[model samples]
Target: MKTLYETSLKESLAIQKRVIGALLMREIITRYGRNNLGFLWLFVEPLMLTLLIVFLWKFLRADRISSLNIVAFILTGYPMAMMWRNASNRAIGAISANVSLLYHRNVRVLDTIISRTLLEVAGATIAQIAIMAVLIAIRWVDVPNDIFYMLLAWLLMALFAFGLGLIICSIAFKFDAFGKIWSTLSFILLPLSGAFFFVSSLPIQAQKYVLWIPMIHGTEMFRHGYFGSSVITMENPWYLLLCDLVLLFVGLAMVAGFSKGVEAR
Candidate 1:
C-alpha cells in the first residue's frame, strides 16, 4: 500500500511539472508570437525601461545622492521594482484569461499564476544582468561589492513579488473590480517601494514607517550589497522572508479553494 501511494504521488508531481512547462511555452508563444523580435521582447522591454530611467536620472540629478553611484543605484532598484510591478499586474485576471486551460484536470489555477510570474522574474533577471554588463563594460558602474548578498536580496524581492502576485491573482479571479482598483493602487505604491531613494535618507520618523514595507528592506539590502560599507541599510532579511512566506501560504490556500470551487461548477 505504501509503495503504491508513493508511486502515485511521484507520478502526480511529474504531471504537474509537465503542465507548468507546457503552460509556460503557451504563454510565451501567445504573448510574444512567432516572429519579429518575438520572445526577445521580454528582456528588451525591461531593458529599455531601465535605460530610459537611468538616463532620465543621470540627466536630471547629475549629482549623486548620498555618495551612491547613480548608475548602479538605478540599476539595482528600478529593474527589481519593474519586476515586482509587472509580475503582479500580469497575474491579475490570469486565471480568467486562461479559463480554458482549467478544463484540463492537471492545469490548476496556481500553475497559471506561477508560470506567468516565473516568466516575468526570469525576463527581469536577464535584463538586469545585461544592463549591468553593458554599464560595467563602459566603466559607467562598478561590479557589485557583495554579489552574493545582492543576489540574496534580489531573490527575496522576487519571492515577495511572486507571493503578492499570487494573492492578487486569486482575488481578481473572484472579483473583476479588484483588477482595476489594484492597477491604480500599484502606481501609487511604486514610489514608496524605495526604488529611487534610500530609506536612511528619509526623516527619522518617516524612515521608521517606510521600513515597515517589505520591498524597502529588499531594495535597501540590495543597495548595501552594491555600495558596501558606504551605505546604511535598514533591512532585516528575516522579516522580509517571514512576510513573503505568509503571503505565499495564504495565496496558495486561496487559489486552491477557488480552483476547487470552480471545478465543482
Candidate 2:
C-alpha cells in the first residue's frame, strides 16, 4: 500500500511538471508572439527600460543619491522593483483568463498563477543579469562585493512578489473592482519600494516607518550586498522573511479556496 502511494505521488509530481512546462510555452507564444524577437523580448524589454533610466540619471548629472555607484545602484534596484510590480500585475487576471484550463483534472488555478508569476520573475532576473554584465564589461560598474548575499536578497524579492501575486490574483478573481484598485496601488508602491534611494538616507523618524515595508528591506539588502560598507542601508532579513512567510500562508489559503470555488462552477 505504501509503495502504491509513493508511486501515485511521483506520477502526480511528474504530471504537474509537464503541465507547468506546457503553460510556460503557451504563455511565451501568446504574450511575445512567434516571430520578431520572440523570447529575447523577455530580457530585452526590461534591459531597454533600465538603460533609459540610467541614461536619464546620467544626463541630469544627478549627484550620487548615496555613496554608491549610480549605474550599479539603479541596475540592482529598479529591476528588483520592476520584478515585483510586473509579477503582481501579471497575476491579476491569471486564473480568470485561463479558466478553461481548469476543466482538465490535473490543471489547477494555482498552476496558472504560478506559471505567469514565474515568467515575469524569470524575465526580470535575466534582464537584470544581462544589464549588469554589460555595465561591468564597459567598466561602468564593478562586480558585486558579495554575490551570495545579492542573490539571497534577490530571492527574497522574488518570494515577496510571488506571495503578493497570489494574494492579488485571488482577490481579483473574486472581485472585478480589485483590478482597478490594485492598478492605483501599484503606482503608490513604486517610490515606497526604495528602488531609487537608500533607507538610511531618510530622516531618523521616517526610517522607522519605512522599515515596515518589506520590499524596502529587500532592496536595501540587495544594495548592501553590492555596495558593501560604502553605503548605509536599513535592512532586516529576518523581518523580511517573517513577512514573506505570513503573506505566502495567507495568499496560498485564499488561492486554494478560490480555486475550489472555480472548480465547483
Candidate 3:
C-alpha cells in the first residue's frame, strides 16, 4: 500500500512539473514576447520602479523615513505588492480567461491559474532578488539578515496570494462584473499595504487596522527577514498565519462551489 501511494504521489508530481514548465514557457512568450526587451525587462521593470520611488521619496521627503535605507524600502515594497496584486488580479480572471482551454482534456482550469500565478510571481521575485543583489553590490542595501525568513516570507506571500486568488476566481466565475470590482479593490488596498513605510511608524490605531490584513504582516515579515526584525513591528506571526489559513480555506470553498457552474457551460 505504501509503495502504491508513493508511486501515485511521484506520478502526480511529475505531471505538475510538466504543467509548471509548459505554462512558464507559454507565459514568457505570450506575456512578454511583444516587448522589445523581452525577459530582460523582468529585471528592468522592478529596478526602474524601485529607483523611481526612492528618487521621488528622496526629493519629496528630503530625508530617510527611519533608520532603514531608502532604496531598500522601495525595493522590498514593490515586489511584495507585485506578488500579492498580480497573483490575485490574474487569478480573478483565471477561469474565464482559460475557459476556452477548458475544452481541452489536458488543460485543467486549476492548473492553468496556478501555472500563470507561479510564472508571474516567480519572475517578479527573481527580478526583485536581482535588484537587491545589484544594490547590495553598490552598497545600496544590506545583505539578507535571515535567508530562511526571506524564503518563508515569500512562501507565505505566495500562499496568501493563491488563497486569495482562489476566492476571487470563484466570484468572478459567477459574476462577470466581479472583474471590475477586483480592480477597484486593488486601488483601495494599494496605500494600505504599507509598501513604502514601516509598520511601526503608523498610527497606533492604523497599525491595529492593518494588522488584521495578512498582506501587511506578510510584507513586514519579509522585510524583517532581510533587514532584521527592527524593520517591522513585532506582531504575532501566528495571527497572520491564521488569517492566511482562514482566507485560504474560504477561497477553496468558493472555488469548489463555483466549479460546477464552470462545467455547466
RMSD after Cα superposition, model 3:
2.6
lDDT digits (tens) for residues 39-65 of candidate 3: 787788778887887788778885654
Which stretches of candidate 3 lie above 4 Å from their native place? 36-41, 64-67, 229-232, 263-265
Cα-based RMSD of the predictions, in order? 2.5, 2.3, 2.6
Ranking by lDDT: 2, 1, 3
What tens digits encode model 2's per-residue C-alpha lDDT throughout 1-265? 5798899999999999999998898888888775758667766766676677768877887656534466787777878998999899999978766788888888888899999999999988888888788878999899898999999999998999999999998888888899889988997898899998888778998999999999999999999899898888889999999989998999999988867778523
Go through the candidates in order and give each one's C-alpha lDDT: 0.84, 0.86, 0.76
Decoy 2 TM-score against native: 0.92
TM-score of each candidate structure, all chains considered together: 0.90, 0.92, 0.87
Can you write out model 1's per-residue Cα lDDT over 176-246, one digit (the tens) per residue? 89999998898899888899888877899898898889899889889988889978889999999998999
Number of the predicted model whose lDDT against the real structure is largest: 2
lDDT score of residue 202 within candidate 3: 81
Quote the positional error of residue 257 for candidate 1 in Å.
2.1
Model 1 whole-model lDDT (C-alpha atoms): 0.84
